[model samples]
Target: MELIYMKKFLDACHQAKRITELMPKLPERMTPRHIHVIDALFQLEQKEDSVKVSDVSGFLGVTRPSITKLLNELESLGAVEKIPDEADRRVTLIRLTEKGKKYYNFYVEEYQGWLLKQLGEADTEEFMTTVNTIARVYKIVSDQKTAPVFPGEE
Candidate 1:
């Protein structure tokens, strides 16, 4: 890639990272990682009643310690519960509490989520530029049709 476009790309990447910070957030509190963990639990909730720590870890593809850390927070926040199965004393099952269900609902139910507000923030000219540049870059990388044509290429 050329130096000028590379510089702009880095700037856009930095802006994207701050996109979440720019928006109004949910009440229970969270980081990006926490969001994913909660989402995994919500997806699991849709499919199975026997949700265990192992099940969450499997869904997230993360190590036990990482899921455990998030689970501990979610449990303490009243968003989740960890209970030992009746038939097996050693196995623990995890599930969303009513508060958690509300929290997940808040994320999925609306255009109010920060990401959905991105398009509204950009003006017409800026939005078109971003879209066109992204399309050009995608075609260049995905199809290998040609070298990247930066913003003002002949």
Candidate 2:
């Protein structure tokens, strides 16, 4: 009985591993750092000014120097522009150009669209239930790692 559920869990893990394998490597001259920065800018959308280096650094838990280097690479690609912040001349803000925005959208949305396509045939609630069940079992195993054993279980 437990083996049946174990098989199901292993199957799901294998499928997720395949999904990771399917994701492409970054393009020439670009690293995951650049993508992380782009994603940070998208999320840090401030009305008054463009996103700043500090913002990306904070979001990614990386140092400003490293993020600045990645930003330099992105700037050379003409994907992003560094503008002087309106409120603070000392601070530089990062803003994605149209090309950068398109690139960011492509990277973020393509996988999401592919996933929706894969799940499209399933009924939504049933899909959610199955996903939730997998999540529940993962928690059970995670808890067991820290749980104290009963007297006979050593």
Candidate 3:
């Protein structure tokens, strides 16, 4: 049973690594980090009038400095605009520019097509069953509030 679990865990890790490697191949004007930022921006775009750097940093689980750097790069590329909040002078809000929206749409479409091609080659039923099982396991793990024990952890 333990060996079976270990084999499944390693296989899942390998699949995750492969997916990570494939993400950078998408057509986008930014790095993976920047693309991730754009994704977040898109999520917030409709929910709120604008998003803040701190909001993105917290949502993405990234540091303020890293978010700032990404924002600066995005700004330079004319992909996003930083608008000062009217209520607070200290707060700077972020919004996608037209160019950013166009690029994001292109990136999403290309990525979906790529993934569909990859998954289409697999046995659909088996692949979906595996995905559903993994989703259930992920939900179970995520529902636990405490930190999980790792090997050699005290």
Q: Which candidate number maximizes lDDT?
A: 3
lDDT of each: 0.77, 0.78, 0.80
lDDT of 2 at 33: 56
List, residue by residue over 1-154, the lDDT tens digit for candidate 3. 6799968876986887576566746445567667778888888787887799998898887799999999999999888999999999899999999988876776655675777887667788987887887767677776767658777973
The sequence of per-residue lDDT tens digits that candidate 2 reaches over residues 22-86 is 55676678765576677677777744345778878887767899889989999998788999877
In order of listing, the candidates' clash counts read: 0, 0, 0
Better of 2 and 3 by lDDT: 3
| Clashing pairs in model 3, backbone N/Cα/C closer than 3 A | none
Q: What is the lDDT of candidate 1?
A: 0.77
Error of 1 at 31 (Å): 3.3
Predicted model with the maximum TM-score: 3
Candidate 3, residue 130: how far the Cα is off, in Å? 7.8
**Number of colliding residue pairs in model 1:** 0
What are the runs in model 2 whose C-alpha is more than 4 Å off?
1-22, 46-48, 116-154
The runs of at least 3 residues in candidate 3 whose Cα sits more than 4 Å from the true structure, single-residue gaps closed, are 1-4, 24-29, 113-154
Order of candidate numbers by lDDT, starting with the best: 3, 2, 1
